[model samples]
Structures are given as C-alpha cells and as structure tokens.
Target: MKSSRKGLEICCGITATFLIVVALVFTTLWFTTFKPKEPEITAYPVGLEDINVFSIFFVRNITLNMTITINNHRNVGSFEFKNATAYVNYRGGVVAEVPIGQNLVPARGKLNTTTSADLMVGKIITNPVFFDDVAAGSLNLTATAALHGKVRLFEFVKIRATALSTCDISFSIASRNVQSTCKSKIKL
Candidate 1:
C-alpha cells in the first residue's frame, strides 16, 4: 500500500517521542526530589496574661508588668527569637529567672509582649498571699526560645494570659494561716 502507509507513520512518531521523554523525566524528578519541609520549632509559648506588681511595698527595686498572648504554630516555616528564658514563680519557689529581651513570634500571628522585672519586695512573703493551691495562683510564666534554624516546625505553639487575667489582691493580713494567693480576677 505506499510502503505500508509509510511504515505506519514512522511508528506513530517514535511512540509519541518516547512518551514525551518519559514525561519530562518524571516531571524533573518530581521537582528536584520534591522538597517542602522546614520547621523544627524550639520552644516558648505559654501565655495567660495579667501580671502587675508595680507596687505592693516591693521596695529596693520594683517594676513588673506582664501582659501576654502569643502564638506561632509553625507548620512549614516562620521562626525566630534567638534568646529568651523568663520564669517568675511564687509559693513553688523560683522568684525570678528573667532574660527575655523580646523579639520573635510571627509565623501564624497573635502577638503581644510587655515584660519587665525588677522586684525586691523583700523577696515577697511578708505581705504575701497566693494560696490557690500554689498552682492556680497563676503567674507561672515560663519562656524558652531559640528556633532560628531547623525543620521540624510547630505542632502547637502556645502563649497565654490575656490581660490582668487574675490576681487582684487586697489583703491586710491578720495572721493565723492567712493566705491570699489570689489568682482569679479578670475584669480587664
């Protein structure tokens, strides 16, 4: 028939050019070995706001105002803050452990930072009062950061405390196991 129809049109154009070069080498090896994984969060995400100690006779050096609320649950990117380590406790010990100059929390939004510590109210205990099981007395702020380079991302970044969330003390003590570890007053 003309040479078998030109050998069946050159074998269908060499099998459609070898299936388009094997589909472009499997789409360039799946876009260069398929990459898209970089997120290994470090730490720092424990918030619950409201922490005011501007005055309570805390002499020698007093100034502590903490208003927290931060969240950055990294999924595949976003991370910073090469330094931070703040821990101010009470009743359970650890009065202070500050070192959060601030900076770093923008991968998923929800930011708010205002930390300052310099208390010396005689190491608080005289006019002390935070006896809500020593724990619910709140204000256990703990921060630790250093997520600048890695690839594990966040699973659930956190940061709580939403403005004077508690502790509105007003005690004039009278002794006799007098406890006032206030931590349940959120009017603002």
Candidate 2:
C-alpha cells in the first residue's frame, strides 16, 4: 500500500509539470506569432463627378468620387471587413452615405476601394454657410469610414476589430483640384 501511494504521487507531479510547460509554450507563441497588428487607412478624392449650381432657387445635385486604401501590416494575419459604411459631411451635416460592402485583405497586402457620394445639394445650399464657401471658390467636406471586422490568425483563431478613418477634403471649384488630409484608428 505504501509503494502504491508513492507511485500515484509521482504520476500527479509529472502531469502537473507537463501542464505548466505546455502553458508556457503556448503563451510565448501567442506573444510572438499570433498577435494582431493595426492597419493603415487613407482616403483620396478622385473627382467631382457632377455639380449643378445653376440657379439659386432651383434644387441642385452634387456627386463626389473618392477612393479609400487599406494597408495590412501583419505578416501572419488577414483582415475580413463586413458591412462597412462611408459617410460624407458638410459643415456638420451629413450629405451622403455610401456602402462599402465586404472585403478581405490578405496578410501584408493593400486594398484600394472606391465610392461615390450623392450630396444633398438642396439641403446643403439652404445652409447659410454654403453661399459663403461658394463665394470663396472652395467647398470643405469631411469623409468618415467605419469598418467592423475580424482579424484571422492561422485558420481558426479570430479576433474582433473595428477600424475608423476620417478625412478632410478641400475642393477648388474653379480649378477642380482636391486636397485632403486623413487620420485612422483601429481597436481590437
């Protein structure tokens, strides 16, 4: 009976040590190989697709074209974006909303997406600041994009992430030129 008890204790000790070693190995691997990295996002104004400012009393329309770029920096993970949306605003008012749909960005890859916004020209022109900006020969707009998705590591592990990007675009009406500045962030 004494010998049997000693053997049982030895087996428990070995099993405990084995479990500790396996946990340490997995922790090290997680830190070194499976951690998710933030992605870079940028927006560029492609052109003004259409603009109608013919009359002061008549309703007008404006269509703006733009492109968004997503750069994934991770070497071992890919991103899957689902049900994203991009919004265009003018002087604190939302002018348009564009759907980005779904996309998959491979590891260390870049994705360029394009969108078009149909501005609510009737609403925009009614604002007091609209005439002032038109007189100045430029229009200032803001573009915001929200992406909700998951970062997949290997084939089975997925981490939920949300990415947001905002850009300030200045359009020169006379020359049809565009200048923009953008900022981006990601949360996991």
Best by lDDT: 2
TM-score of decoy 2: 0.76
If scored against the real structure, what TM-score would every candidate get? 0.22, 0.76
lDDT of 2 by residue, 51-93 (tens): 4344434655556677778888664788898977788888998
Candidate 2, residue 45: CA error in Å?
1.8
Q: RMSD to native for every prediction?
A: 14.3, 3.5
lDDT of 1 by residue, 1-188 (tens): 99999999999999999999999987885455422222222222222122233334445645555444444433233334444555554544555555555455455454566665564445554425644423333323222222222222353533221112122222222221211222211110
* Stretches of candidate 1 exceeding 4 Å from the true structure: 4-8, 15-17, 43-188
Q: Ten consecutive residues with minimal summed lDDT in candidate 1?
A: 179-188
